[model samples]
Target chain A: MNVPAATRAIVVARIRKLWPVLLVSVAAALFFGWLYQNAIAGRQAGGEVNLGAPDAWLLLPTLFTTAIAVAVAFACTSHANRDPFALVEDAAPLFGRERARANAIIPVTIALAAAAAQYAGARLSPHYATPPTFFLFNAIAAIAAMLVALSIPLRDGAARILYALLACGSTLICTVVALAVIGFTNGVAAAKAGLAYYPNFNDLWGGVAEASFAALIGFIALRQYGEALARYDPLPPANE
Target chain B: MAILEMRRASFARGRTNIVAPISLQLEEGGTLHWRCELAQAGRVLARMAAGIVKCTAGSVFIGDYDPKIQPVQVKRLVGFIPHPPPSNPFDSPQAYFAYRSDLWNLQCASAVERGMRIFLALHAQPPNLALAVSGALLHEPKLLVAENLEAELFDELANLRGAAALFATR
Candidate 1:
């Protein structure tokens, strides 16, 4: 569909309007990457678990999630463009436009700062935290912004996908907490230590977090394409 | 049966009266020419824009029912074109004709052939005057209301001595 120039302009305006959300999303990916490269990937795990393995495939999900964050940012920009958030000159600002600009940006910067803080915080306090838990909180927060971006007004597809990932995210975080308690109290016996030594699904948690973030961002970017598909994204029929 | 009745309707923009209270009666297969001066075209075109003449205000019976209430409903059976100039920025006359064909609900495929022929015959380059517009006219309209057309289409009017024989109805 050839989005009229007028519509495209509105999208840019919306992006500027919602710049903070996008900033935080992109910032989260960078922090996630930092955690993967510096925190989890650095530590020595069991030979089988392989957190320190060279060229580990663990970074895949982190990259994926980063792409998704970009997509959501682009979509938010595109949607605003698609419908100019304009009201009658005398009327109040449009729905999403009403958010405080300064406050919004502050949170975005703070969110990124928090993610970096979390990643470094975990790397320093490795005994108290597991690799999965370190990445999991960042994942949860990145997922939160995706949920918020997609849940605005009538569009909920973003929200739905974010919700599903978030559910899976909760399960992963819970497992990490359980492992930490087990490792702390009973002590690291050979078998238990081997389990920790050998890398497991917890590593995948960090990877998946990145993958999810990037996928969301990539989708939004594609949606911004001018003269794209002929139809508005009609959600698939209920049965489909 | 009379298709429309304007009744003494007057439309205004602010204090200016664009079109005064004008009344006219139309029936299927009826063709009438205003034969008024050049400025009258603007007034008549305003009526087309107002949805009063083309659809409502008057008893406008195109095919089955009165179109006064169903403004868009009249579009399938009717097509309108205002004089072109500043409004059309398209590269070629055909470019706009093709776009407007779908936009105005006219046949698109044949528009290319018809547009080429019409522009070639009536409108040449040097002077480039938008002499006349023909849409759904190739098939023949039951009634055609054209304003400010050149002398060439005078006989094309359905009531003209040489033309009424062509449509056999309008």
Candidate 2:
């Protein structure tokens, strides 16, 4: 049905209104990445290069949390603003499932791009080497968490607040679980040693599990969003 | 068979009924002007017939397709001009037509050019009723639903061969 073409059209329309927010999302991610690099560099110059001393271990979690928060914020802003689809909605030969998928494009891209940018920036630190295998999977998990948070019905003020909290909490939980998996597989000794070498198979398996978890959550959340989009009635709000 | 039909369809919010149960039909080359108050209730009714608002009871159909179950097919068959038409986002009429062509994923450049010429010819006043109708007709839909349209324009619109029209009047 030329789903890509339909999705592209919708995204283009949305981008006209939302380019500023998207720019901010990317800038914020880059800034955080630069900040992480500085933090690690500062710790290394002072001779406290260990992960625990500089709280270097907190880097991944913090990065993911901030990226997801930005994504959630973007979602809220888009929702509160004028409906982008209102114009062509009734005339276009696109239904609810396609609409839902089209809607997710901007936010999901924001989350993934932000995560990638920040991780790249942090890699510039002299103390750090290649990124861990699990980090990518955890980043995916963050995307899933963001989707779950966005799936919360934005009918009212209470729902908005709940969505924000859920976004933060879900991403944070996913990041922590991913870290815990790595910690358990390699123990505290590996963490105490600076992150220099590539991650082992144990770490890789843990990452797969974490990424799989994210995929499952994202799938379910997307389906729910599609169903809700189908049932959604915009008349009441417009009439009021 | 009717190109558009509503069988005792109704819409409500909470306990209040926005549109009372109503039945109507329009066939090819025919026209129906529904008279109601313009602001709230009539707008809702027009949207219901266009499949933008689902009926709380009964059903609505466009060329044998139920809007609730086959929204894409119904939308493909129907051309809609809403009460408060959306403003033109593009700088030129050609750009607007291009945007529509891209959106609907149709290679109807010729049709778009024809629609644009019609739009420019008729768009002399404000609120852009001409632009709305011309844009709606770009898809060459079998049924057209226009809300709160000017009565004088109906004769002009009827010139389009074989397309049924439903106009909501104040």
User: Every model's DockQ, to 2 decimals?
Assistant: 0.02, 0.44
The reply for model 1, stretches above 4 Å from the true place, is A1-240, B1-5, B14-16, B35-46, B49-68, B84-88, B105-107, B124-132, B135-141, B147-170
* TM-score of candidate 2 on Cα atoms, chains taken together: 0.80
Q: Report the number of clashing residue pairs per model.
A: 45, 0
Q: What are the lDDT figures for the candidates, one per model? A: 0.38, 0.65
My TM-score estimates for the predictions, one after another, are 0.34, 0.80
Interface quality of candidate 1 as DockQ: 0.02
Compose the digit string of candidate 2's lDDT tens values, residues A1-240: 555667776777666655776677667666677676687567557776654333435546444544454455445443422443455654578777787788777767667777776666656545454354534754676587667665554445777566666666666555555555655666654354333222432366457656766677678877877787677665624543
Report the TM-score of chain B alone for all candidates. Answer: 0.57, 0.89
- Looking at model 2, residue A147 earns an lDDT score of 76
- Taken in order, the candidates have interface RMSDs of 18.3, 2.5
Model 2 pairs whose backbones collide: none
Q: What is the TM-score of chain A in candidate 1?
A: 0.32
What lDDT score is found at residue B69 in candidate 2?
88
